[model samples]
Target: MSMREINFDGIVGPSHNYAGLSPGNLAATRNAGHVSHPRAAALQGLEKMRANLRLGLAQGVFLPQPRPDHAWLDRLHQRYDTASPHLKAQALSASPMWAANAATVSPAADTADGKCHLTVANLMTMPHRSHEWPDTLRQLRLAFASGAFAVHGPVPAPFGDEGAANHMRFAAEHGRAGVEVFVYGERGGPFPARQHREASEAVARAHRLDPARTLFVQQAEVAIAAGAFHNDVVAVANERVLFAHELAFEHRDAFYADLRRLMPEVEIVEVPDARVSLADAVSSYLFNAQLATLPDGGMALILPGEARANERVWTWLQELVAGNGPIRRLEVVDVRESMANGGGPACLRLRVVADPATVDPRFLVDEAKLDRIAEIVTAHWPEAIEPGAIGDPALIAQVEQARAELLRALDLVELLDS
Candidate 1:
């Protein structure tokens, strides 16, 4: 069987809310305390998955880890009322809905060895997200236990790691060995640069990636301060094509030069400053798009609805797709529920390239599975959640019960207790 890239999107959790915990995330801080509709969010996600499947793209799904993570919080011995704001924020966060921050993946094709490798991110820079790796690893192992995959623990902390949000892979074909770009920031700006150079290197070593094939680049300081918290905020790549804002990297010339030297066939699709400023891109989330290779030998940009709402971005994208470019089509997905909390279409999913036989069968999905998931969401997920409700003990119990129903419905009961 041929290996292919599969987009594994995380289902929006029942506790999905706007805590505004992520410091550098533009969307999170901008829309703090907005009401969230859990049922609508999950249904929208399922519909997006169905849309991808209808387009003949390989789509996979992951269960959201139970939230207001009581087990992990219990270790600290602080009751809900006594917990500090940061601690409370950590417990109430729905940030896991943005699974791009979950881990960095290097497919078997890119690794020196033949086994696919995954490294869970520490996310140590943010109080709410720092506690995710432990629970995330538990689920990753449960779903990727096959011999074809290697799940590595998060890089030792004191070093921040933001995962695939800062990593991009490119090659002549989806299933072939590719050049992996690890974008890091040195924290020169006001907001912390989440992907530390040390963490990126650790992941590359864990995957046993060839030094020649792996390249490290620094994220633009301006981009970080302007809320391009992760590289995905300013860049995206699919196969041999990279769509990036000109200011995405600290040293743009050197970065592109390295790519040209290493991968001559690489196609550089830069959004120049003259066309659209970095500020507009961050505000519009123009770069937070899913770059998928269509079977027709063309590419498509799966953009968030917000992208269309932004006149500047929408105008540029319209011209780009209509012009002589690799990206020939556009699809807009409404992920406003999660998008309000600083995530977009790309943020909701993690792309893994491997054969169906290599991944745990439970993670794969079809039309039937989408219908079942939608039914569960409509039946059990909360219709609405408010920012102030995070403090309610009753809401916690409600979320816990809802997640239990979800686990049983998906036959992922192993994660229920986790």
Candidate 2:
């Protein structure tokens, strides 16, 4: 029953391309219709995992969902060959690679049933992401099949749930009872607020989280309008530390008071707007980082390369690390491809606190496994994917075959049928 935090990153798919599907994500929209390098993207993700493993953290991976979801296309009464551009883009979307939007997880320590409960996100706000739940659920169930876990389906539609991207948990340690914070949104000027308050409440109840320990906070509308579409885009939490931008929440002071009441040991690391503006935070993905507790009881911020490039953000981070701060280390990774598509280090992972033994072995990985996965990516994944290449028969064949090869390599072929 030794519990630890395991990050399950979604492997960047062979169909990884930028069609500008997400409206509020500035990076995705800015780089829309640009050519994508699927092979390089997947390799970057794998190298990130390897870096984590080297840091003595347990790492896991979720396979890319089947592309050209023919069944979904058929349901829409449209064939890939004859469908409209918009419809075709939706069908071939690789948005699921951002695993933070995969589910909302409540560890066994916080749930009434003493089982880690994960509810799949409905993602109803965006047309391109709305259909991801079924496939996500399949992977969740298979990976967390042990009795120590309970995987639930998505919250009903009309109530958008974007999963862990909008959630944060703070505790003294990984195995202890913790306070879970669910961040929801009401309004964004032009962009749709993705995570609804109703959806957060539903997930809280379904996970059987103690109402006393669960807090619902509103995301700042201004931050959303500035391209912080999800809460994680402006904030991230690890153990007892909350590393966030000052404009992350609607009622920042009230939320801080309530969080302190729930967990007295909580540390709030708020970055002011003067230091790094909300626009800079979103564009550089400074807050969209993986704040992880190290094996030696220290903390580290696994940031994307963009964070290091921004002068303001980088200077603030350097000062924080140089001083006697909780986050002692800074590790910058090159996930430029994912960053271009609006996913940083935090966006690419789903954080689950559980005993490693409880999760399916097939999902967990070591350095050797990552190396094998990289081989498949180098051999099968497409080197470059143009926007118009999504619907091409040749590209589709290669995409499907690449995923099949990874599944076979990992001995997780059951997912092919799923």
Error of 2 at 334 (Å): 0.3
Model 1: per-residue lDDT, tens digit, 1-418? 5788899988898888777877788788888878888889888888888878877788888787767777768888877666776677688777777889889999888787789999999989887888888878987897789888999999987889989999999899988888999999986467988889999999999999999889999999998988899999999999989999988999999999999998999999999888889888987788999999877878889988888998888999999988998889999998887778888889999998888877777788999988888888888888988877877778778878888887788788888777
lDDT of 1: 0.86
Clashing pairs in 1: none
Give the C-alpha miss distance for residue 212 in model 2, angstroms: 0.7
Give the top-scoring candidate (lDDT): 2
RMSD of each: 1.3, 0.7
Residue 101 of model 2: what lDDT? 96
lDDT of each candidate versus the true structure:
0.86, 0.94
